[model samples]
Target: MAIVREKGAMRQWSRSQRQCGQRIALVPTMGFLHQGHLSLVAEARLRADKVVVSIYVNPGQFAPGEDLDVYPRDFDSDVEKLKPLGVDIIFNPHDLYVRESPEKNRESGHETWIRVENLERPLCGGSRPLFFRGVATVVSKLLNIVEPDVVVFGKKDYQQWRVLARMVRDLDFGVEVIGCPLVREADGLAMSSRNVRLTATERKNALAIFHSLKRAEELVRSGETDSSVLIEQAVTAISNAGGKVDYASIVDQETLKSVDKITKPSVFAITAWFGSVRLLDNVELSNN
Candidate 1:
């Protein structure tokens, strides 16, 4: 894969590709890739003539005390994993928003931010207030930089995927936002880059998050539709397995509001903490 670190050069390559009439597929990531991330790359390969995956750890989404400092970075290893996939380009830009003076950001008024508004009020946003704005902004930057015909985001980050999809629509980004299905480990823990930080026991306990979601799916299949009842069951299961529940909610997949009954298809989503690591997972349910 040809690695382009600067945004201008990346855009030039994208322009050249467009001139040649090659469709570009982009998979944006924060490096330290895993099988789940690679799955997105594989999906992109099937969807477009040229695949471009970006590996930049965005600072905008991180909070003051979050795991931003140690978020994980192995660019060399990440490239090795992408090599076999026949990826065409890697846009590893250092900064999407460059400040003339580093010290000015602390004192200067924030100039720009992209907010999905109501879509971010629940789930991850409840605790991480600045999360979506950073995500929307950085993703908007990437969408502009790569200017791909299609962009792929994993469904594991259901909220992020939805936020970016909405951003693309509202802003008329002219790029297709494709949400791929979530992948998991054999024990059901949704694969994550942070899974490496989980101690042996914590890793095992982490399975509770997925199992609890699975239980909710089983309940739905068995004709249970009350959202509160499902949330209670999920909370109990995760607690028993040693996870602290952040939120166990069943919401309308589109609106993201808690639904009283599963009259139509819905999403059962949860976020729990095992030690300092926060994990999220969700399952989709529909009558059909």
Candidate 2:
């Protein structure tokens, strides 16, 4: 696959595709090749004539003290993985975030930011206040730069998927955003790049995140609808397994507001810190 890094070249190549009437699909990622990422590419293969996967660990999306420096990187390995997947192009931009103004901040010199209000107030956003601002801004940059016909995101990052969907609608980007299913490991833990950082024992304990979500699902399916009860059980499960709970919540899938019962399709999502690694997982609750 050809690696397009410079903005000028990327725009030129994408424009050529548009002129040739080629349908482009993009899988935007912070590099550290995983099955979950490849799953999105598989779907993109079916959806478009050309698949462009951009592998740039966005600095804008990271919080001030987060693991931006040591997150993960294996560009060569990532390229090897994508070659077999029929990925036509890999847009590895050195810097997707350009300075809009001269005002410099901790993360960037640009003061311009894209904020998705309401959706950013809960879940991951509640903790990482500037996250979706970083996320929305970079995604808006990529969507504008790549100008792909479609972009694929994993449902594992359920809130992120929803946030970007709302951003696309609100901004009228005209690119189809597709949410693929959450991919998992054999042991039931959601596959994440950070999984490599876990100690063997911590990895075992990390399974509790998934287990707790399942337990909450069971609680909802069995006639328990109280949000407090669900949160209590989830927190207890993760804590017993040695992982500290950041947040365990059940909320309306679309609105993301906490719900009292499974009156509508909802999401059971959790974020926890296992050792130095923070992990997140979610399960769906739908009426029968």
State how far residue 25 of model 2 sits from its true place (Å): 0.5
Listed per model in order, the count of residue pairs whose N, CA or C atoms clash below 3 Å is 0, 0
Error of 1 at 27 (Å): 0.4
RMSD of each: 1.6, 2.5
Candidate 2 residues 82-117, lDDT tens each? 999999999999766565454755665467888899
Clashing pairs in 1: none
The TM-scores of all predictions, comma-separated, are 0.96, 0.95
What's the lDDT for residue 211 in model 1?
80
lDDT of each: 0.90, 0.90
Candidate 1 deviation (Cα RMSD): 1.6
RMSD of 2: 2.5
Q: lDDT per residue, candidate 1, 61-87, as tens digits? A: 999999999898999999999999989
- Estimate the lDDT of model 1: 0.90
Query: Cα lDDT for residue 277, model 2?
Result: 94
